[model samples]
Target: MILTAIVQTKAGTLVVDLPRDRIDLEMKIRSVGIERLSDQIHIIDDEEKSDISVKLFGESDIGRHLSLLFNENYTLFDVNKTMQFVANSVEDIRDDLEMNIIHDQYDTPAELVGDIERMTDEVGQYTETFYFPLVGNMEDDDDGEQYEVGNRYLRYYEYEIRELLQKEQDLDGTNMKDYFYDDDNAQKKMVSCQWDVVDRNNTLYGKVEFRLREPFTAEEKELVRSWCIGQAADGLGEGLEQRPIETEDGDLYVSMWNSGDDYFMYDEDEMNDYLAQQQGGVMTQ
Candidate 1:
């Protein structure tokens, strides 16, 4: 049940295949220094997608940080745990366990020395300062680290993201970016900043869709869009997809207080069926 893939090492000479089953979970946890057992845990899963991840919920006895991602959440655990609550007595299952454990360690000063390389663990920066232009990460900075800096509003991209944070407050892109980029507490009217807008997940592959209050040139429109999303994400702390979706009624707008999902869908048949159902529903109505 391991995620099948070839992983290249830091040295180009070494190419290692991912391990599905190497050791037992007990041994795995022990390897990561989970000795005292006061480790708090939180799990995020999408049952439909067969995805599950167990992460450190709070400070652990082992001062380090850890999280586990399984290819098939139920299958891996089911094979290992079988019917046990504790899952300590698992055998061949452990040797065949398919998952990845990311182990981050700290130095005497508590700054991360580095992530101890485990099976398929990706090396990471000790701390990351990310700007949320459209979505403020709701996930806790339980690593005792503030990886992402936020502003005020957050939405998945409801027009309200614009109406509420922009129209209501009169804050524009220049001000919004300045406010977010500044990690200081000072009396300030407006700060200057660059136009750095990222899609959800803080990546370049993000789509933002909307109409503006007054018409503007292309450059002006770009700044307005960035400000609109930045303001919404800084304020709301959460948001949905900002990509343009056209409907018979009009451009769909939502509130920051809601949630939705956008799959990287490749199921053409399924999508067609869904669209057909929606069309039927509309016609029926």
Candidate 2:
């Protein structure tokens, strides 16, 4: 049986033919540049000039095994150096075939596998560094009204999302902004809430809830409540919703307005109920 394959290189393609009968079980198969191709496959002091050698056993399975080994070795050969080697080897092979002679390029299967694996690992690392911090917090300063609180909130949320992605083992180098802003599938899977704080007459008031995206189910609402409590605890030194009273299957909401010296937490339910009672007509339930 004769096994034939084509080796492609920058210069051109060279054909390889292996005779099953003459295959050696232990001898190494090495290639040396023919005289005419010596200029293309440069030799460094003539000692290191030949193409790599591969080993083969006389069996049907050996051809399959050898093909895999050849691919791996060629991929790892310092791609630039390997290209030159392949160009020269192909030239030599073509010359030999024209002269009715045979030639083989040899490489070990293990070496090829190792090179390919290393290249893959390097590429993966590069991708991770490029996409790790999509949205980062801005620095704060005393010269102006720095959005310190808002920046911290964004940082915390980003960290939480990163943790979730890590848990799912999906931390590929993908831009978070693209996923959140551009992709519809991502929009369906992820949720974001924005809080706008307004300063009126030296008093601060804010509203917290989902923006653009809405219909926050009970679970999502509770999650927002917990996140709000966390933010308040970190920024204001206390959890504002610790003893939230249940109203209409939701926690009793509180709105705070704080001046330089006076801070008041409004009982949102009490204010609404008082208004309802004053209007009468069964208080609108």
Model 1 CA lDDT for position 90: 22
In the range 1-285, model 1's lDDT, one tens digit per residue, is: 222212111222111112212234334434444341211211223334312233222133221122232223223222222112112212222332212122322321112111111211221111111222133333233442322213322224334344443332221112222344322221121112122233332232122222112234445434443554554443333323332223232343322221335322112234335445646633210
Best by TM-score: 2
Candidates in order have lDDT scores of: 0.27, 0.30
Q: lDDT of candidate 2?
A: 0.30
Model 2 stretches astray by more than 4 angstroms:
1-191, 199-203, 212-214, 236-285
Listed per model in order, the count of residue pairs whose N, CA or C atoms clash below 3 Å is 13, 7
Q: Estimate each model's TM-score.
A: 0.16, 0.20
TM-score, candidate 1, is 0.16
Q: Write the per-residue lDDT of candidate 2 for residues 138-226, one digit (tens) a residue.
A: 23333423222333343334434333333222111121222233335423433223233422222223433232222345454344344
